[model samples]
Target: MSRDEVLVSTDWAEQNLNTDGVVFAEVDEDTTAYDNGHIPGAVKLDWRNELQDHVRRDFVDRTGFSELLSAKGIGNDDTVILYGGNNNWFAAYAYWYFKLYGHSDVRLLDGGRKKWELDGRELTKEEPSRSATKYVAQEPDRSIRAFRDEVVDAIDNQNLVDVRSPDEFSGKLVAPAHLPQESAQRGGHIPSAINVPWSKAANEDGTFKSDDELRKIYGEAGLDDSKDTIAYCRIGERSSHTWFVLRELLGHSNVKNYDGSWTEYGSLVGVPIENPSEQQEA
Candidate 1:
């Protein structure tokens, strides 16, 4: 997929704010940010409550996803434009979810909320009212999703991109600094995985870097574009951003986001782990 196919500029998004057949959704790590003020007519998708399954550790099932979209007044054919804070982290995650359920025309608002705010774009507290539609979602596309078993097997066979902070990658912290340092039984990265912080793919304005720069960024890190790649982070949102960079922007054919990520991988008893911090301590 080309950059234009998956990303729309903030200016373009502003022009399409009221365009029919187009839907804007804000998915932020700080879910409450939407309530404060957001792009006019954009809907709020609470990542924790709406996107994730309530009873299980997995994502919302197809039926649940359909219901959520239906309630959000989104149609199957709507051109979904997703944006959010933190350089589109949760937004890309929601974008990934849209693809997983076969939404054909989903794109990210380049630069997301950060750039919009930086440009002094208009934000509103009033929510738009639209009649809900009965949206149908397709079966989960496992092609872009990596399970624990697949991630384990890919350790040495495929490219494992640990899109986490260096501290987390080195086992100095189990999670990001802002969050509690606990989630997994152990701390470290998957053996043979290379650390590539997801933020590297985006500029200060929150827009993704150019394709050539992206290729060089990963290539210099020893990533083989020809090999199947799996990206992972603590709970998978950050890695989803990297997954978008690799799969959608870079056009890598076989790239998957292991949603379980370190939370699952680090807890597995038999999996091989490389804790540089531990090695240093020893």
Candidate 2:
């Protein structure tokens, strides 16, 4: 897919703020950021409470997803424009989730809230109101998602991109430094996986780098475009950004985001692990 197909600029978003069949939703790591201030006419999607299953360690089922969009007044035919803080980290995750449920026209706001704010655009505390719709959702798309077994099988065969910080990949930290350093039974990236932190794909303004720059970044890191690829991080959110880069922007045909990621993989039994921190200690 082309960049324009999957991403919309801040200018485009500003112009389409009131356009019919276009919905703007902000999804952030700090779910409360929306309450503080958000783009006019945009809605808030709490990633923790709205996007995830309360009873299980998985995403909300298809029915729940349908209910969510219905409650948010997001119809199946609407074009979803997702944006958020931390360089659209959770927004990209939501984009992947939306695609998983077969939403055809979802796109990320290029540069997200960060760039918008940096550009001195207007933000509002007011929320929009709209009547609900019967938002039907399709079954989850397995092609763009990876499970634990598939991850293990791809260890030596596919392009396993560990999109975590150098510290996390080397087992020095289990999570991002800003967040609490707690997650997984152990730390370290999957064996044979290349370390390509998701932040590398973004510019200082949170906008993604040009297509040529992105290609060179991954190409230098040994990513083979012909092979299928899987990207994972602590909890899969950051990796989703990279997944968007590789699949949607770069147009790599076969790439999946392993949402189970390190939180699931590091805690599993009988799975091979390579802890560089431990090796250094030895």
Candidate 1 wrong stretches, greater than 4 Å: none
Model 2 misplacement above 4 A: none
lDDT of each: 0.94, 0.95
Model 1 clash count equals: 0
lDDT of 2 at 193: 99
* Tens-digit lDDT string for candidate 1 (1-282): 788999999999989899999999999867779999999999999999889888989999999999999999999999999999888999999999999999999999999999999999999999889789999999999999999999888878999999999999999999899886668999989999999999889899999999999999999999998799999998889999999999999899999999999999988888899999999999
Task: Quote the positional error of residue 159 for candidate 2 in Å.
Answer: 0.4
> How does model 1 score by TM-score?
0.98
